[model samples]
Target: MTWKKLDQIRRENPVTDEEEYGQAYAEASLAFELARLVYGLRTQAGLTQTELARRMGTTQSSVARWESGGSLPTIDLLDRLGRAVDVRLELVASHHDPTSSKDSPSCAVAFGAR
Candidate 1:
C-alpha cells in the first residue's frame, strides 16, 4: 500500500454529481463558518466558555458544542450569544436566480460590536 495525498485522490475521483453532494457540502460549510464565528466572538470578548455560557444563560457544554460545530444554534440562541458577547447580530436572507450562474439562495449572519 502506498500513501496518496488528498488532492491526488480528489483529482482521481472528482465529484461528478453535484446534486448528490451540493446540499451536504453547503451545510458542512455553514456549520464550520458558524463554529469559527462563535469561537471568535467568545475569544474577542475575553470570555471563557463558562463565562460565555453564564452570560447567555446556557450551559458551558452547549457553548462547547456550538464552538465545535456539533450543533447549530437557533435564532434565539444566536441573539442571546450576540448579547452575551456585546455584539450586534443581523441575519440576512436573499434569493438567487436558479437560472443564473450564481449559487443558490443563502442566509448570512453579520456581527458588529454593541
Candidate 2:
C-alpha cells in the first residue's frame, strides 16, 4: 500500500509503542551529522589542531580530544568554531510529508536562522 494509505490507517492506529525507537534514532543521527560537520569545517579551513586551538582560545590537546570524539562540544562552541573559520554552517531540514508514514517523527534542528 502507498504511504498515504498507510498514514490514513495509522491515524486510527497511532503507533505509540515505537516512540523510544524513533527518539533514539533521531539522537544518534543528529549527533553523527553534527560531529561530521565540525570535522569537515575544521579541515576545509586548512587549520591544524594547534591552529584551531589557538582560534578557539584553548589547548591543542583539547582540540585534539574534541576532534577525536573523546569530547563533544556544546552548541555555543559550535557557533564559535564556525565564526573562527569564517564559514556559516547550514542545516537544511523539512517536514516529512504527513503522508509518508515514516516511523520517525518531525523535529526542529538547529540550522542558523541566518
Candidate 3:
C-alpha cells in the first residue's frame, strides 16, 4: 500500500482516536515486538518455553506471558535472556544538544560475548 493510504488508515483507526488509546496502542505495539523477538530467538535455539524459562531462572508461565505479549521483561531479565541465548544485549544512550550541530555523546552497555 502507498504511504499516504497507510497514513490515512492509521489516522482512521480507533486506537488513534484518543490520547489514551494512542498510548495503549503504542505500548501494545512494543509488547508485540518484544514477544516476537523473544519467541523467535527461543525457536531459533530449539528451546521450548519451559526450557528457556529454566535457562533464565524464571517460570514457564512467565516465559509464556512474555512470549504472548502479556508482560514486559525487566532490563536485568533481558540481560539474563541474552546470556541464556548466547546473544549480545546492548543499551545505548545518546545525548543530543539542540544548540550544537555536532554529534552528541553516547553510551553502550553490552551483555554476553561477541
Q: What is the C-alpha RMSD of each candidate to the true structure, in Å?
A: 4.9, 11.0, 5.0
Candidate 1 residue-wise lDDT, 45-96, digit = tens: 9999999999999999999998999988888888888999889988867675
lDDT of residue 107 for candidate 1: 72
lDDT of 2 by residue, 20-79 (tens): 879976876766666677678789999987887788777788766666655667766776
| Candidate 1 runs further than 4 Å off | 1-17, 97-114
lDDT (CA) per prediction: 0.86, 0.71, 0.84
The CA-based lDDT of model 1 is what?
Answer: 0.86
Ranking by lDDT: 1, 3, 2
Which pairs clash inside model 3?
none
Q: Estimate candidate 1's RMSD in Å.
A: 4.9
Candidates in descending TM-score order: 1, 3, 2
